[model samples]
Target: MMLLALALLQAAATPSDAATEARYERCIDLATTNPVAARSEAGKWQLANGGWFAHQCLGMAYATEGGWSAAAVEFEAAARAAEVAKDKRAAQYWAQAGNAWLAGGANDKASAALNSALSAGTLTGLQLGEAHLDRARVLYATGDLDGARRDLDAALAVVPEDPLAWLLSATLARRAGDLPRARKDIAEAESRTKEAPEVQLEKGNIAAASGDEAGARAAWGIAAVGKGAAAESATRALAQFYAK
Candidate 1:
């Protein structure tokens, strides 16, 4: 997942920072339409003592190009700079760094950055919820199922409307043999939306676990026709069923 960029430049509070804010906005504006140029601009700005915002702009530019590793590096630098400046947005920067690190396939680094963000005690509401959710992904990937479950629960508590959190909670509940909890969460997910392939796949998993073979097959079949990682997973699930 990509980090949500702050709209800091959208409303500058003082004239002294107007020029810097305009430059930051320009860098962000180019990230979508001309990321290469944005990167070049950010590099120049950084060399000109543009400080943390320059690194942040560079990170956004790299993220636009799917250069995850470079984005992570820049985001981490920005986070550190934000912290040193005693900026309230430091937690958000750390969270963004964590997300970029995860995108770069650095789970350990992601986990550490996420920890820093959470420990900052500054993130609130959905932002904090999302941080917990990403940390859960890292924990799950590291085989720390218990830790993942705790984080997922925390995420759901803060963002009950998040279908992904419910789906993951259901999947983990099922794996832990808490069928009742799993069914409840999966039903909640189903009520929210049925368009996601992963949701369909989880629906199938719950059905299969409950010995409802036909229901499982139906859901998985729908999911298998979709694209991306979820569809690939659904395909593997269907193959396993047929092989049995």
Candidate 2:
């Protein structure tokens, strides 16, 4: 499961001066209608202003077309520009760069950007939680389970209501053989978001761990109807269950 926080970041990464906001709004509109032309316009704006917002617009244009690597480059440029200007928004730009890097599956680069974001000491509340969660993902990918778990704990403390945080926490707890914590965490995630296939899949796994075959079957059946990887996983689980 992934954090939904990126959409919020994308909405307000730039400074909120009226003129800049107007330009950013136009950039958004044009990005939806014509991404190529939006990139062109943003490129010209960058040449003229060379401000963080210009790079933000360029990132937005690239992101519209699923160009994650290009988007990460533009967001890193925005971050560097923000740093040069001593803007507090540098943290957010770096976080956005991390998100783009994560989307591109460049976990090492994502970790670097996220580290810069956290080191900025400007993020608070859900933004801080998101950064921690992203770092946890990188740590988990790199087999640093203890570090990943610590970050997930930090993320949950900051954003307890986030279903994705709970889901990942549950997964990590289960992997570490903390079945009770896994069960509790997945229950919390289920309460926050009932339709999440990852939650359901985890619930099934937790039930299986507890030797509750019926519970496992029920949860997996529900999860199998979902779209994407979770559904495929649930289907495989059910097939394996019936095979035995």
Candidate 3:
């Protein structure tokens, strides 16, 4: 799961004026550096009519503290407040809420928030693509493969440079028995970064699916030495392959 606190921070839009922007920036900085203090300050600010930006900072503070559900609530509140003011930031807040819900393992709520974000039609560029990518993840988790595929395609169209999008597209294609597309998309991902363990693991999986055991072993060898879940998975795959 891509629990992206930094991405949420980057998505923060400029406030209406200079003072509001400065305050938001300070709160966000505090949220990252000292979440407890940020949360307290943001709460007081919210009660003092700090508006949507206050809720946004509060959400960031909660996220930094690993309070995904609370962060989601704050983001949702920010979205509603932005909507009431007809602000473009509403879509961004909805997207943040969806991501927080996803991080919290609330797929149903994530889907709802993502739906609102997409329906707003206000998101553009990479933000729009990321929103689609996130929705695709939610759909895939819910067993809606077709929906996931559609959203992935849309994401790829908008963010062709995003290796994660290509990696996911490749994985989905491999799962759906579309080896040709899997190969193409994985190549796109690999071209972007051959060092990524997940990319290497997926490359190994695709190679194994194609009956290329040697190729699989080579890729898995690279992945096994890397870190995190992908490395662990690659190690297991090598064991299973050798046993077979």
Candidate 4:
């Protein structure tokens, strides 16, 4: 009968819902480390549910990998769905939209989305920290050094244990011609995260600035294992140094 068919449809939809949710979580995880794989699986779910999480993940895949155009589409879709969800995840979508805008070089869009994310009031502590960090980076890129400094300060105030704020502070200090402060901050950040090769690279920068050739070489060697693009260039630097 019609009623039996309706009940069966609802039953089938339940498992599909669970599977979609699982796929979203998987996509978020894989997107960071292996975006191609993440997108391949996530695209399948997007064909069905394509809800906030799916759009957000797709957006993240583009933003993080520097594919700005594609990121904008997914992030905008995410923002729309997130507002409709009216749930905790809504703020996250707002942040993603802002980040994608920043990646896309659409400064105004980034600012608006970031403001909305703050206003939404659902961001987790870590999410808020990351948002501040990103906003600060964008501000710096746009030559708003004063604004960038303020945001970095705010992020550090919120999460003193996070090494990234310290790292950013060091870079900012160096750019501002405060080598002493840069050295001190970079040293602290490097000391905090011994396992992170990027920290080693930061330390290497400080060492080079201070003319500690041996120390810089050692740090750069460690940093060569990092995922940063500079890793390859750093290896070349090392090769040139040894060749000398």
Give the Cα lDDT of each candidate. 0.81, 0.85, 0.89, 0.69
Better of 1 and 3 by TM-score: 3
TM-score of each: 0.88, 0.92, 0.94, 0.65
- Sorted by TM-score (best first), the order is 3, 2, 1, 4
Q: Score candidate 3 by lDDT.
A: 0.89
lDDT of 1 by residue, 1-244 (tens): 1112222212112114788888888888897679899999999999999878888888888888878778878878887987898886778778878877877789999999999989999988877888888888889889899999999989888988877788888988899988888889988887887767888888889889989989889889988998877788889989987798
Listed per candidate, the RMSD to the true structure in angstroms reads: 3.5, 1.9, 1.8, 10.6
Q: What's model 4's lDDT at 217?
A: 93
Best by lDDT: 3
* Clash count list over all predictions: 0, 0, 0, 0
The order by descending lDDT is: 3, 2, 1, 4
Q: Model 3, range 116-161, lDDT digits (tens) per residue? A: 9999999998889989998998999999999999999999999888
Model 2 lDDT-worst window of ten: 1-10
Model 3: per-residue Cα lDDT at residue 64: 85
Best by TM-score: 3
| Winner by lDDT between candidate 3 and candidate 1 | 3
Q: Least lDDT summed over 10 consecutive residues: which range in candidate 4?
A: 1-10
Candidate 1, superposed: residue stretches over 4 Å from native: 1-16, 240-244
